[model samples]
Target: MAMLNQIEAFQPENGASWELYVERLNFYFEANDITSADKKRAILMSVCGPSAFVMIRSLLTPRSLNEVAFEEIVSKVKEHFNSAPSKIVFRIQFHKRSQRLNESITEYVAALRNLSENSNFGNTLDDMLLDLFMIHNRCQIAGSTSNGTNLHKGLSAI
Candidate 1:
């Protein structure tokens, strides 16, 4: 139980995923032989940070924390913190993601991949990614113009 005090409060804005935090907490319980459900609940409430604990309290309003089981608290917190974003929201971000001027193709592709994570692109993910990359790359190439003079001059010569 003493060793379990090392568990840090989860801050989603700090880039720590809830899944990873839960995984670590479970492993800590296993290592320290803290199997008591009551203890787990107490530890979770104590270690969940002040803001989250307040939120948890609100989530259980009208219901006493003592009456609520460990699983219930964990489930409620997980639902609120780990809810998935809408697919349309993800797709909008993915579509609006244009490569920055200084960003390399590799970086741009990686950004696209990250943006596409929850996009529900399904089996066409690769196809769509390739198509966007090609289109954007072409635009980047031909998008340049010296008052349209160079392009027009070259075309006139041909």
Candidate 2:
């Protein structure tokens, strides 16, 4: 509980504020041989969720996450996980936004992949990948439909 609180506090409000938190988390993640799936999930979910949202929103902000900043974020996250980021993470995080709601997820996953690749955190990266898959599934299940239909037919399908 205490550790979780500390971790929450460590998260930065924005990219510029994340430098120190990223450094400390990286150190802890590297020093410990993390074997727990839950821990990995927590770390990635906490870091990636806000990060993805921020990166996407940053696109429209006055000062945004440029290529250099994006790469820096990725590097830090990778160091924490201690593995090369998988391509799936890269596809989600770094790819330019698409027309759908998934644009944010894609950018954040790319950041995770970039960071993991530099740092070499396989287990952590794997955990992130798994979580991303689950999250994607949940999103699809929540909003997706089998066929195109108008409001009346859509309601009938439901």
Candidate 3:
């Protein structure tokens, strides 16, 4: 079917998302009314590609891929490839990062956003980003000869 053709092979080595690939595969099954367990497993095994296949083989250990149920295989692969990071470590990185010289505001913000992804910022992400941006900018302003009172005052308002 047309939908099935859209499924890209899962390749972790290439930075492809196993989560997204599985999501799309699930969508494919829903769209095409593919309810059979064996058929789903077959399609998954075929589509997951070489790199993932090798990973699956290793993760399964003594048991062959055939010995596992579909859900078990999916669980093992997802856990292996998409394991969550330590929140403290990610938060430290997020806090420690500052804009590099020659980096534009857009690039710096993008980097901050990327670093914050696993920071567990939850509801305070926006406020934290604003605070970091302001502190770094203030430091930059202070290092220059120009008066930064106006910027300091503005930042103090928050």
Off by over 4 Å in 2: 1-5, 9-16, 35-42, 47-73, 76-158
Which tens-of-lDDT digit does each residue in 1-158 have in candidate 1? 26844888977666456667778888978988989989988888888787767778898988988888888887887888666678998898888788798886667768888778778897777566655644666234233423333322322332
Candidate 3 C-alpha error for residue 34, in Å: 1.6
CA shift at 82, candidate 1, in angstroms?
7.1
Which residues of candidate 3, in runs, are more than 4 Å off? 1-5, 14-17, 81-83, 92-117, 131-158
Per-residue error (Å), model 1, residue 42: 1.9
- Against the true structure, candidate 2 has what lDDT? 0.45
What Cα-based lDDT does every candidate model obtain? 0.72, 0.45, 0.74
Better of 1 and 3 by lDDT: 3
Residue-wise lDDT of candidate 3 within 12-108, one digit each (tens)?
A: 8765666777888899889888898778887888877887888888999899777787788888988886675588988988899987999876677
The local distance difference test score of model 1 is 0.72
**Top model number, lDDT:** 3
TM-score of each: 0.57, 0.23, 0.60
